[model samples]
Target: MDKLRDFLKSWPGRILLILCLSPLALLGIESYFHSGVDPNQIAQVGDASVSLNEYQSAVNNRRSEILENLEDASLLNEDVLHEQVLRGLVDRALLEQQAKKLGMTVSDDTINRLLREEAIFKDENGNFSNDLFATFLRQRGMTKDQLFAEFRNQLSLDQLNASIVGTAIYPMKAINQLIDLQLESRKVWLHRFNWQDYQQQVTVNDADVKAYYEANKKSLKSPAMVDLAYIELTPEMIKVNEVTQQEIDAQYQSFKQELGLSDDRQISQILLTGSDAKARADAIKARLDKGESFAALAKAESDDPSGESGGAIGQFNPAVFGGDAAAVEQALSGLKVNQASKPVKTQFGYQIFMVTSEGSSQVPSLASVRDEMVKRTKAYKQQTLFADKVTAINDLAADGFGIEDIASQENVPLKRIKNYQQDNNTSALSQPAVIKQAFDEFVIQDQSVTTAIDTGKSTVWVQPSRYRPAKTLSLTEATVKITQVLKQQKASALALKAAKDMAAKIKTEADINKQGISFQALGDTNRQSPLLSDKERSLAFSQPAPKNGVAAMASQTEMGATLIVGDAIKTQQQSQLSAIEKAQTAAIIRDNLGQDQLQDYLEYLRVIHKVEVNDANMASAQGR
Candidate 1:
């Protein structure tokens, strides 16, 4: 069980965890909209009924993970995979029931701890926030209570599984054996018998070639290939009307509203200060009311620092004015362009204000924004059209319409792709998701249209139009290959005989120097030696300890044969096992043994409580 848990904690396990927790569980993106399966009962374990929706969700999740990692997408079409996924769900249901029978429970405190410890639910200060946790649950279509309930149930099941497999105590003898195997090294004297020497002298004739071709023709064939008819819809394929005058006007209004602009004024003010500032301000306003220029009045008689530059202040809204400015705001709002106001008291001081510039916020005209509006309108319409078409196509497919029928009704062109194979592909349908759907059991065997598959950039529907089975190669076409094969076979036979003769001579003489064979001495080589083939190295280890440094025996490799004379098997002393190494080895042993124990317990539970599945309902569930 520890081994299984460790595996689940790895990259693949994390992916599975995400799937189980994610809303709709690996029905992929398109499934987010129409992921529901029928809720009818499909299987039973003891008193528990596994619903069609639940089984389908499990299968979809597991299948998605397998297809993502597996190099060949075609394997997704296998019925055995469907069976395995269903069985896994059934087993899980059985285990849950067993856990309940044993009265396993997870406390509320434990649940709270789990939620608090989850880093995703934390704020910048690393404290758990109820708002963030609630938001997370809401996004995944779950209420806080529902998520906690499920999490509690999961914890109970985990405890149950863990309890069945106690800490494993691996036998000392087995541990020693594994340790020795890992550390052992060998010193060897090796001999080589090269097959290339015999290859140059071997001869093949036309009859031999013909016989070889006749015997092996069936094995030389191409894999099964398929041709496809598919309808693909992308944003680029959407055609909509050009931007009209009305559309541009509406968009401009929307843009203006989004910007939230307001009318603003640019002001110039001469602030007066000191004990008699109010009186001074009133006198300044009187002078401004006269024919005196405001800038000249500000430059000569103003008491504030801004008086030097005619008291100019940049354009701003009333809200942008700072401090106890209620009176200033009211005064500024009433003034017109190029108009002066009476003295107004402010946080800084009493001031006389003039409005130099005023403007109302307005949207840009059509001509100035024509090109950008056209682009945005086009993109918006295309997206709307693409989404509508995708929905329509999916609806039609669900209603028993073929892709061709949908294409015709929706005014989309149906394109055909030829010679599609698992590895050799040339179409956009070559995408793994497309390939998986095209070869799905229902798509090929039952002749059904696939569910609308969104490929991020495009949505696609596939129908298999033609299927070709693999066929044997003709003898006439295989002659050249057969000739080479025959020569290799004859050469290998001759080489084997030579090797045997050489081995016999070496054993009798107890020496490797004879029969034109050259030997190299490898000192203290381990199993991972790059100089030798895996088979050769393993064979060297199997040889008995050398008798007075003589070659033990000879063995065969793929392309050649060899003999090894071993000096001794060198291994680490038992006391040399480091503390960390011992702990790691013990953990591995425990995990291995624990896994076996868990499997046995699960099997025992299955027999004690009879489990049943309905095949007919399973098939019907898949059809949905």
Candidate 2:
């Protein structure tokens, strides 16, 4: 399932799935072109122009992805999304031009290889199926050539980026310095001065708060609120009759066939990689032919992480391995029980496998899987009823039925919420789809009934009854909040002053306990995560062995201030940078450098090609 989801999120996934979020690898979009007539251009990049239709397609794809991921569609700011989309498209065009100039190309073989490796287009046996691939294209109204072209362009961009990043290297000296700070740890004596302790030292009169309120009155505006009357439709509200025995029997058979109840296999194997993997695999196979124990040799010589378990890779549904599934299945297909196969080449390298067991796939009797099936069928029937009920309720609303009137006709209770503000996100009406409809300009201005809003699991229809514009709050309404704010500020200031005084005492070697401040020992903590606040942690690391070895430092926390006396400090050794860490650090440095280079190249393209953005058209496209 994860593999399928990942495939749906990739370049091909975006093309096949409706949730395409980015236009970074916009390959075959040129296929959307109309008959050789002049098209309205949105932007010009050198000699190439972005058609308005192309930009809209990209924007809509990205918008759909966003709405699917977020709960509240109203949270999407059209202006911001439009700006990002246009910028991304412009950058994509620039990179494409640069790729052409550099003569970088992606071959047809690479595109074919990538598609074959895609998990979603594969059968249950992990083998690529042309039928599944064609189905995906047909569903999205695309052709094979169109998607393949997009893949080629995407691969070219990836190669270009890789070439730029490959040349970047981080100096060992800088890396060592970073390792020291990153791994350093400290043990300390800490003291916290609570702000609540200083509450008695401060006094705030009504006059101060009133004066502060008067000066900030214009800025202290109340959020606009609305009153709503809505209909809530859920699957649980519908009653479902019994599912027929014929329907149950048919569904059970379908499930069994879909789940491949005719075949099953239990396999165990050893995987080996590296330049000598083939030779090593051949050697392993030779040992097996000579009757060497498979598990014993696997435990001794295999490189796979599962080698520790005597190479028990476990049973899989064969169809789960998309890339090299076929080669593996083919090798095992001819092997008898307890028989080992010769070394087989796969994407993960050479592997020697043993078929531990084989049998017909198991199918449970109807009695064994019936209870669960009955519950599922009931829910399915209920959902169908719910959908019909919602449509009827919506029809009533469209025919000038008020929420209460609709509720009476449908025999469902109506819910009304008054003075609802958007910021009260905890409210039921604050649900994404409902909030989007409730606050819609047309819904509020024309008092129109919103289209059925699906909140993923439920459906809601909201109509605004009363709307209130945001305005300055009255003194009576804001007085209590202002008083609390003033009190907190006064307490914090007094606490900060007291903390500074205590810090001075600690530096002078005075007993903190005597001054009524209890101290606790914090042992061996890195600045990245400490018992103290971030500021205090940073201050502890910065203090220079404390003057005369007194070993003390001071910093502030959210509640008040803190003083710490370092008991011991442990610095990470440069020798601790393992080979794996070195490679990881180098990769991080290379990636950052690659991004910087890409940004600079894009800027250079903009200057040379004289890129022009059409703000008017962009605004129109965003439906501003």
Candidate 3:
């Protein structure tokens, strides 16, 4: 118990815990209505389960991101997104389980140094700020122990991934050949057959337009759409209640009390567990009294993983150690630096602690964390209000009331959307979750409000109004479009024939000039050149070296067609590559190979772990 508190309070304990709280990658979201370890699991992979809140959170996250960039959120089908997000979570669970089975761990020294280096926990003077760290965790509803677990698990997962990727074959001979291809360049020339030059000469009559429209009528159908009515609850729509000065003062006092900020102690321990723990602890105390080194004794005698690190448990506090903390604190109260405590009974076993170090009182004045206190106070109030509102809305929903009636009762605005298509991702209320629910067969047939659907910042209730099936347009409506399409096709065909004829006549660059054909002198370029299209780059560099002067080949392009003439095929020696270039090229190859290897390993793990997806839960998603 003492050892874990010591570990948790140390800078390294929750390294990834804070980072996993990526604005993108959620780590225990404060979605009280959804994010708790609820029974609403979407998928079960072995013993690990992914909750519905997790899936909702992922959807909301993705939807909001698309909305932020002014892109259509409806572009992705919510059902598909649901599958993708759930699959990812399940895969993560599998990797973590596998890593645990293999007994993988992040070394204490490595994690600790990383945490201490984290800028979020650092003070103005660059020292680890326990106050700031605690505040951050409090906001996120996380305890230090949770942070430790998160960091350990995340690191272990990364380690497993890296180890598998490391197993990728080098295949240096093939790699060198690929590298040679990448470094190869070519001097080329293009012979053009412009579509515009042929379009003016080709005439299309009314009969042609009618025939083309008749054949392509199915492709010109109008979009299918649905009408919707909904009431949404976004964070901005909810107001935060005020926190009083008295509340701030009370919170300040509580922080100091809970953290034991008066005097912070750092300790190391030698633990003796099992039946004869007390007796063994006494024996070690006697050896310590004889002037043997505490660290050396702990390393040789302790029954804990920390034993490898000379039993250095790091910063100690009561919040982490819990009930056993009372005895440990009392034992440490009388001990000075380098002084050892007598055998103390803890949850783990009997531990003899030595005060390795101590820090000055961490007690902060109300003025010193004032801004953070106000922020924390308001956030707490806001969450309470949000949860209350959600509950109230939920109750209103269950009483057989529609979205309009509920909105009126709750004083939230009701909204109606017209022509809501599955692909209409750009509308104000076009959240993928909402769109998905609006289009659901159950909701469409039932014509009743669905349960609460959580978006990134909002909770939604949707009811379908009407459905509009797709219809084919009349020939008159499709004539203009059909004519344009038919014209481009004929023009392109003519251009390709012209280009092929040009290529057949001109075997060399000099012959191209002799034929009075216009072309672009595309200078030396490699496989990855920005000046050439992907196809153009491959065509330019891949042609056989000219038997006489240059080689010409014809191919179709977007605009028309092109006769490609390769003048010279150039190669750069691998020895001439700069150190950075070589490193970059090697990184590309390794990254590609590593990803494939990692994916193969993950597939193997999936089979071994036996993943079972709850399709009903993933599909229904009837929110709490």
Candidate 4:
């Protein structure tokens, strides 16, 4: 008894014992002590005993799967583990209950067949590999029977879920309609109103300013603030000296060799113009065949902007031409001297080529490139060193060292900022992590304790010198600001009303026609209309057109007139639904309206099952 008491005092020992005993209590004391226990004895449909061993196994399996898929071992967190396990247990229970309700059953034959064909259990010849199957089970620390049982149970539960959710499908007409909507394009003329144009005319009175200030006093209240000291390490400041001329020459020679420019081309061009251009081009090709000067012909006949300067196209890599330059490359592939290419027709027009000379593509030695590398390497090393230094400083602060001591030791200047908030308003702090750490340290019971935190680019040590509680605004201070907001809202309402009145004045299509404006019918403009601005698009679809009058508004730019659809368009769309869509749409409407019915059904199941959770076990699992 004394030993048991001592064990219970220890956190880990207490947690393990509690978890192990809870399942036994739920399954009954006798069954808990027995060997070769029946898994079903832990739970029935309604109230089930969730075994600690089973839950742990499930968590391990899930964790392993996540690690494999993410290829990252460091992603594991206790909170995530707890949440996933709890969710899995709850979902498993729900599925089991659903399976029982549907009378779904799994037999040994079904389990065997599924296992044999599961791909994981199959050999190269497509035959069931019993050894592979056994190995996989062994890896998971499960016996063959245990694995089979779990597989069978899961299959039954899956069938039950499928029956409830049903298959998702879209009819041909719906698919076609979706496709058309995606592909359809819209043409629109847009006019914009500049706010700057109206800003000059808007005047602020003394009363207006006072009212605005009063109403917005709460918004202007100072937020919770923090002050922090940080150190930043960056690579760009690192300096490298003493690069030799020999090194520079070596690098230049290496770069030159790598360029391999000796075999590159410098060619001239000419473009034949006008409607009979093809015929003129053929004639030019014939002259080129007769060995006329290619450069002279390009200068005389080519309409290219580069026709001057003897049509010099300059040097180029032959590999970049792809198949279009295949003949030119082949002809000049082994040419060591200057060569001209036969006329070739390209999509742009006809082209000629020339190979200037041959060159090597060798690169310089590492010794040659070492000077530039040293500068870059120095910067990289400096940045890394700076990060490590900052981390050490943060560690010192976290261990309760003062920021002043750190700054003095590191020989870095430390500045104290006042009236700063740790929240989103702390934009002036420069180092966000420093501010955050300061706020976190300040909130603790120990007022003198300092902490170090990462400020993204640097590490900071924060010491909270003082703490301030939040303050609410006085009513007198808030009044002026409120009045300004109210006034602006009133102005907006009036503007909207004026726009609507203008829209009403244009009653018919005749009004638009009489105004000399052409009406372009937009047939079933769905979500993809490019002509509509975001706000206009949303309003157009949602509000539609009114029946009696035009819904006109000044364009967003305040430069032109605009109209929203009136009642006739809305009526037409409603009447245009096909029979099948109409039926499906009605069913959707019914389902949305009858969501309460589904909730009631789930509630009825809960009552019949009498579900219970072992709160002690859950708490133990959560390390609470």
CA lDDT, every prediction?
Answer: 0.68, 0.72, 0.73, 0.51
- Model 2 Cα displacement at 78 (Å)? 7.6
Kindly give the number of clashing pairs for every candidate: 2, 3, 1, 27
List residue ranges in candidate 4 displaced over 4 A: 1-108, 134-157, 167-387, 411-444, 447-466, 469-471, 508-526, 529-535, 542-624
For model 2, residues 406-427, the per-residue Cα lDDT tens digits are 7787888788888878555567
Better of 3 and 4 by TM-score: 3
By summed lDDT, which 10 consecutive residues of candidate 3 come out lowest?
26-35
After TM-score superposition, what is the CA distance of residue 288 in candidate 2 from its true location, in Å?
Answer: 56
Write model 1 residue lDDT over 235-288, tens digit each, in one string. 888887777655654554455457785435678888888899898888878877
Highest TM-score among the candidates is held by which one? 2
Candidate 1 lDDT score at position 236: 89
Q: Which ten residues in a row have the lowest lDDT in candidate 4?
A: 25-34
